[model samples]
Target: MGGVAQSFGPFSVRRLMDGVFEAPVADLRHLGGSGPLAAFTAGVAGSTLPMDVNCFLLRSAEGLTLVDAGCGSAWGARYGHARAAMKEAGIDPGDIDRVLITHLHGDHALGLIESESAYFPRAEIVIPARDFAFFTDEAQRAAVPAARRGGFDVAARVRRAYGDRIRLVGEGAVTEGIVLLPLPGHTPGQAGYRLGSGENALVIIGDALHLAEAQAADPDLGFIYDVDPVIAGDTRRRLLGEAAEQGWALAGGHLPGILRARATEGRFVLTAV
Candidate 1:
């Protein structure tokens, strides 16, 4: 897959394309059956929607940090690109100093392990405490209502691979100039990382808004994967609004192309960065 790169102050932000998958249009029920949604789908005129699976690498003189790993081969054949994409960008997994995970969803966290080992062997893994508790606690795993227990099972595999190297973080600067902004509701601990010092900053919002075309058109519309649709909608609106207001570059795990966001006429718009 081809890679996309951008500079954020002294840090280099690079996009690693994992792969793409087709999602049914009905999956976007949050958009409702009328208004702009009808028009939006009519524009595409397709039964299946194309969604990109992406991960980003943040590099600086002091350290190398990765924001979410792509879906591993375990999820499906369409994913599993972290190692290859890094190699394409001339980066070795061992050279990464830290991995800032937004959440523990399979597509975002399964790449933590490769071939039954820690993919980035030397990097410190950072994750949200809420997610760590929800996905790793045996009691919580057992109570996860069956349908969602698969995530806990996969997370257990990751825990076994990374072991003591994992670090749980809250709302604050995780390292250097990168700060963790908790954007929950997609998952209890889903978050985004804020990087760069000034005007040239960017936020890698993992799964905050999967389809930029639809969500950017209407943030109130929620995806089926959201753990709490109401809260997820609020988080999406707030974060995207903040980004637009501050003129910050925005990126997402499932945005179709090189992602960036802006606001105009009371609506969020995305462009390739």
Candidate 2:
């Protein structure tokens, strides 16, 4: 409906498509803080404190799938427009069958709730095993710096709410035609997903690239939430290089646009087409 739905690839089976699940930027700014706000404002003129929180719904034969759930109801008070966006995309939360969580960050997983329960009741939540452990472990929670403690709490609540629906996966193909590429460092189990085959492939990179300017131009620019900056930078460089060389469409969890890929300048760039 409208311009929210777009398609790629020459055929249905091989086609990679995405729908925008728009949420408010205010919620994102509040959660991400001033640093993210400053970065967004500087990169995109007129950008204010909160940049819109947009999630993606990917279509495949297996059924409707979601990339990251935007900040759910808890944070909805400030940024609840995501639900309306989903409606605009014609996706009923109950209809989503699978949710691939890129990491345990609050902004990404917080939206998995509905009335104090898992929002996607029948959906199987896919997460990295390493990240699952990291957020669920009490010892690890205590180890996080005071500033990051809130994130740990949010992640824990998600785990408790989803419980059995959570399915931990690793670096490899978890489903036919879909591959989970491990891109750790942003979190213990941060990951990216590759869909389709040959030249028709698309990769959904979650939180691996926060700001297009810093990530696309300088993969080395690390974010405050990156658990391992060095490793995260390396992963970004490697993924960016591979996507560019192979001519695969790339999508970032936080980046604007539905699909983006690096141009062939041997430098990181984003192609909205």
Candidate 3:
């Protein structure tokens, strides 16, 4: 499905597509547990699976809020349409009052800046404090194994764009109805943004569950980039459980289609609404 918009409580959320990319099956083997990787890719014809990159545009009486910036042109042609998608939804980058970053992952934050300029000129970029400190620390980044060094570079570039406009926040409401639901382990301070109250609420699970088919069916499945798979799995279970019990809607950063979901039989069942 194409990028769609939905409403809940006082917020209007529009799903903005950032294009798609293929992920190698070998890389996700660790998340499969005893379920063979072949089972995960059974229907797929290729050696890699396509993952959708999505960001959210939320509007309320208070202001416009973007859940995650998305992968810009920097990531190449496979995933760099966030800005265009936003415009298609009748929202502009400069009009975004707040940019709530789920994490500093290259795809989630690269769109925050373009050529070292703030993409959302007037927006206050709200970021998790733990992530801000970790990704921006040159020494700490260098300490990360060489394979993961590129993450630090992307974070540094995004940091340079926000400058003073960046606001570091801990667990709690970053704005009017938007609450930060901590979902660490994916990143040092990765989180999902909770909007609204009671049954009408929606939680944007940014990178908390990358492969929806595998992770949603089995929360224990770990992504390759999870900083702590065990903790991440626990967080996923708890959050999904709460969502199931409370009847709260869900949106994932890499979900295929129809962001709305509910946990049934310990698995997330997607809904068109």
TM-score of each: 0.90, 0.80, 0.90
Q: 4, model 2: CA deviation in Å?
A: 3.2
Model 2 bad stretches (over 4 Å): 1-3, 8-52, 263-266
lDDT tens readout by residue for model 1, 1-273: 646668887787888777786878866656345575666667767788888888888879868888988876767777786667778768887889988889998788888887778988799999988877777778877765676676687678878999999999999888888888889888888888888744587888888888786788688776567777788888988988888777777888887555567888888888876
Order of candidate numbers by lDDT, starting with the best? 1, 3, 2
Give lDDT tens digits, candidate 2, residues 122-141: 89998888888888788987
> Root-mean-square deviation of each candidate, in angstroms?
2.3, 5.5, 2.3
- For residues 1-273, what per-residue lDDT tens digits would candidate 3 score against the true structure? 235567878988888788876777666644446565556557567677778888888878988888888877778877778787777667677788988989888888888878878878899989998888888788887777777666677777776877788899999978887889888888878888888877798888888877765676777766577777777888877887787778778887887654455767647765555
Measured with C-alpha atoms, the lDDT of residue 117 in candidate 1 is: 87
Model 3 TM-score (2 dp):
0.90
| lDDT (0 to 1) per candidate | 0.80, 0.68, 0.78
Q: What is the lDDT, from 0 to 100, of the residue 61 in candidate 1? A: 83
Q: Which stretches of candidate 3 lie over 4 Å from their true place?
A: 31-44, 258-268
Residue 124: error of model 1 in Å?
0.8
On the 0 to 100 scale, the lDDT of residue 146 in model 2 is 79
Q: What TM-score, to 2 decimals, does candidate 2 have?
A: 0.80
Q: What local lDDT score does residue 19 receive in model 2, on the 0 to 100 scale?
A: 27
Worst 10 residues of 2 by lDDT: 10-19
